[model samples]
Target: MPSPFTLAITGQSLIHHDIRACVDPGFLQIVEILKKADVAFTNFEGTILGRHGGSPMKGSYFGYSDPQVLDALKQAGFNALALANNHAFDLGPPGILSTLEEVRARGFLHAGIGLDRDHAIAPGVAAIRSRLIGLVAMDAGPGPRTMYADNARYRRPSRPGVNQLEVTRIFEADRAAFDMLATIQTTFQISKLERANYAQPDDPPVLDEDAEIDFYGTIFRRADVNRRVIAVDPDSASIHLEAIARARSREQFVIAYLHHHHWEPNWRDVPDWVRAFAHACIDAGANVFVSHGTPVLQPIEIYKRAPIFFGLGNFIFHTEKGETEWSSPDVWKSVVATCAFDPAGPLQIDLLPVALGGEERIEGLDFHERQVPMVASGKIAQQIIDDLAERSAIFGTTIERHGPTGRIQVSEGQR
Candidate 1:
């Protein structure tokens, strides 16, 4: 065994502008912590769509910025990056190719996007501190067909895209909702017959056997209801588990990471499938697990002696543009996670609360502009620590104040 090793983890990073010029001093201190770790990791949220190549999606936008952002990340101590976020396929194949080229050229180990599903699902291996580390990044969603990597056929190759974990949404309507849908089906039948009599070539499928949806046509609206469950596609989970099992035999540690925008009824708790997936990976021999994309800190669970971060929020969230960038408060805060693991297992985990800063955010529009992540102070910092402790309590994890950060307490036996 290579003694004990520490892994520093963080959430999404978007370095659209120059980090050195736009960021402040406190951000550098956080970087110093990351540098001290055996391996430092973060999810790269934006894509390098190049200067003049890609087109945006139909209604929504995909993240794209200068390719030089890779250099900025290297300076921040990110030796490895998760590339399986919603933005992976933003610029199509060219973007995917460009990203892989730049990231690899910069000497960063990244996994997620690939030319086909096999490579996409495969783990990116790194030899850190004489111990082999394997990483597999995936996302359940924030959807569009373009974002997922496709499995290849006998001859034709699969498309270039991000690794995907398919989530099957199962609708379990109650008596009222079920009856209403049935009524809609009956009414739609009459309309279909009328359309057929009126010389329409084909009417829409009233009852979709696969979808369990009763709708008239393509243009329809479905209200938010509780009679449904987000189920993880077992095939996808098993595929990843198989990879982890293989890596475990050959490597010293395996880190499985997921990037999804999915959340539970309250944005605080993790969705059931997320928990299930984390446990499955640990069972398959993953030493550490990570999740991001909620953009807010959502508790932590120590599963089978391994740490599972459901959502780490933003390590560096300098949102200059977004639909609600001007109003959303959740984007301004997050934490930096530090984990110390020895050959036996994990020893200690620390959560340091940090606040995102810049001109756009802060004491209103009057604050000076700069993109940086400052160690939160006073009331703002305590509030984050308190909320995190409350959320993590369900998993039997405790948070005690240690200077400006919170030390996540785990049983000594659990280590």
Candidate 2:
């Protein structure tokens, strides 16, 4: 609504220390490109390690960032961040509190982690120029239960944590798989002694060919037919829908993002629940949908005139000195997405390749060994384009390469 605007986005960035000097000259151009966008977003993983100075907290060190290092992010032009990641609570409540304080003081729009459910789930809006843009963020699981935000009753104070999308797992199988699973579950059984046996009910058993069998609180049918099922908690979906509608009323552009480790067998493909969630977001009035968590790029889906990036991989896949166990070679490569939307023209999307690695840093600022996301070239760049083109093909999304970057082709009707 405010003329033609562009949004540049990226994947997860994990920095435990300041990295102002980590980026080389070529990569600084990409930072400038991000600075020039109307709105720029990224998945800001970890808690802002502020006030505590360089002192470590009582929880896991998986996600702890020095507060001063945020200046480096500000220098690179990241105005918006999503914070409902697995490591949001790695440093516990104190870390969460510090992160909120720093992010607000820096004047960046953020969503997800907060002191209560409403605070965590609420959309963070930014009035950039004359346009009001809103963003809502959540983390879906098959993940650590302790990371979820407290939704305690009015009388009881809510705990500090990240926003959550509840996940209910539904397991299904045919006759053979069902029987095999039952047999396996039986192996862990503890036989009851004769003296420990309790009185039985007088009611007769209800048995049918397609009858339901209850084992260890899991229900399965005896039928031979094949069935596929997924359980997305209705309450969580409804809350997200409500948030989207509320944001739609006050803003010209609404962006929704989710962070999850849920994935399918191919690694590049997303879970069915994620697809359903994306569709639901569009139905609820979101202009763009994005997902991350798995440190590799997944497919892009087009739904109801909106774009959904299932996963954007890792924009800065740095491995800290104490984080040797978290190392993965594939995560070092990623894409910087440039999205253009016009009220009178077709939408356009482009991706620039990046490689995360650097040795330079400011003196006396070393909280941990850090690596910067640099501009990628040669095979590193080519692989990212090829992977995106191949995976995005499933949704009829096309990508073209012109050296180290690629362009996403979308027609007027599709947008």
Winning candidate number (lDDT):
1
Clashing pairs in 1: 4-342
Task: Please provide, for model 1 over 1-415, each residue's C-alpha lDDT reduced to its tens digit, 9 standing for 90 to 100.
Answer: 5678889998788657667554566777788998998899999887786633666543455567678788888888889999998877778777887888888888887888887788889999988878788998898885655567777788956778889887755566655675677677786674555534543222333445543553433212233553557778788888989988999988658999998877776666788888888989999999888998887788888887789999987776545443443344555678888998865544688887787783235445322243667777667778888888888889777778776679865555773
Tens digit of per-residue lDDT, candidate 2, span 1-415: 4587989989887666666775477569779889999888988887876773333433554557778767878888889988888777777767778888999999888898988788898899889867888889998855555556777887966777888887644445678977875676567662223112321211122323254434443345655665544567799889987899889977558889998766665566678888888889988999999998987777777776678988888776556455444444455567888899886667778888876662223122332444567777677788878888888888878888988789876667773
Per-model CA lDDT versus the true structure: 0.76, 0.74
Q: Which candidate achieves the best TM-score against the true structure?
A: 1
Query: Positional deviation of 20 in candidate 2, in angstroms?
Result: 0.5
Model 1 stretches astray by more than 4 angstroms: 154-156, 189-211, 214-226, 358-370
TM-score for candidate 2, residues paired by index = 0.83
State the RMSD for candidate 1: 4.7
Write down the TM-score of every candidate.
0.87, 0.83
Error of 1 at 140 (Å): 0.6
What's every prediction's RMSD, in angstroms? Answer: 4.7, 6.7
